[model samples]
Target: MSTPRNVQQLFDLTGRVALVTGGSRGLGLQMAMALGEAGAKVVISSRKAADLEQAVMTLQDAGIDARWVAADASKPEDINRMVDETMERLGHIDILVNNAGATWGAAAEEYPLEAWDKVMNLNVRGYFLLSQAVAQRSMIPRKQGRIINVASIAGLGGNHPMMRTIAYNTSKGAVINFTRALACEWGHKGIRVNAIAPGFFPSKMTAGTLAAVGEEQMAAHAPLLRLGDDEDLKGATLLFASEAGKHITGQILAVDGGVSAVTGG
Candidate 1:
């Protein structure tokens, strides 16, 4: 018998299905495209129907099988429907990317309770709840799936005095730990859970900061001497979604271009 020619095929995702929350724009859209390019049928969801439709078109134009579902991660009913619809439409969700999140900025002393609750509700609570629903309903029964939580470097360190976003930092910090804890519990079930902590990327969330300070500001603190570009997300995301990362779980992979290593340096 002859050996097959398909060597190094661990990264292929030809028959998988992926569900990405907040996939209408920014990093979520980027990751969705990456997965689609890797041969997975992608389901993108967000609070806005118009944007989700537009994203679907964009992904389709790229020759990728993409669909859209409008749902707010913060709402329990919406979360349930999102998962249900994905399963009903796509048949099964082999991968779940918890990328829908928000941030509010205000000094700690002046931060309002409402703001904190809002941020935590979606970033931490919603992320975990949606993951739980998916795990119990789809992954646990099949005993196979991958969950990737999008976190931030802000979670790895204390608040930067330059920017006051206490609630955002706290929520991201919780997400990192949440990934670790959930991976521990779900690993034995053949479900791999992990997190990706990205550095400064040019997205709607960072538009204000990047415009106000420019690339010089981002490079000053980052060891890479440059802000994150669109292509930076592809490799890290594909690694986790593919067999290349089969042994990795409960890990927080920092794709921040060496920013996490600097400590008051």
Candidate 2:
């Protein structure tokens, strides 16, 4: 391997292409922008075309080469179509961010079976299917790729008194291990797989839960005593997407402001 002469070169992603699921907003968009700003051509996906369009504009406004496709990441056919479209439009994909996810909050007894299935299908199954599609269609064939799964600090444990998202938590636990197993299997093909398990972040997904529990109280649980913001994910995304993390894989990074380390009282 050629050693990078400068620090910036390690994070440089010129000529690379990245696809971020759920990149229409929130954490997905944050990571997408990170890859884009670092010189990658980025394609974002979501279920809504309007959201995707707006996000594309937002990225372009920020001077990033970005585009989008509308598809439900949970559906197998949609996943396949999105992959085909991405490859056709971008020629090849160097990075795939499985950031698309869904969450549900309810007392375990009252939690409908439907909600369980919804969360599991989208959060866990969706990630696997997309990653598999990308690997088979492009990454494996090219013998080069990066897969960054968006896990959560919630996956590491189950002690959040403020939230009752059982399905989401379980799915994320699967994601953490999924990243590890895939990395070990795909390393021989030059495909890197890793995960970023974030803490409480300001987003539509967390709005309801934060409202019920109060954002301040939630933030205080973290050692940093704060919720996540737009830029928190950028550096980590770049690290995994660029040459900076070429030697790193099968790892789960917690961007949770130290929340994962503390247990419930």
Clashes in each model (backbone N, CA, C under 3 Å)?
A: 0, 0
Q: Tens digits of per-residue lDDT for model 2 on 27-120?
A: 9999999999999999999999999999999999999999998999999999999999989998988999999999988999899999999999
Evaluate model 1: give its TM-score.
0.95
lDDT of each: 0.90, 0.93
**Residue 205, model 1, lDDT:** 86
Q: Which residue pairs collide, candidate 2? A: none
Poorest 10 consecutive residues by lDDT, candidate 2: 256-265
Alpha-carbon runs more than 4 Å astray in model 2: 1-3
* lDDT by residue for model 1 (38-130), tens: 999999999999999999999999999999999999999999999999999978889999999998878799999999999999999999889
Worst 10 residues of 1 by lDDT: 2-11
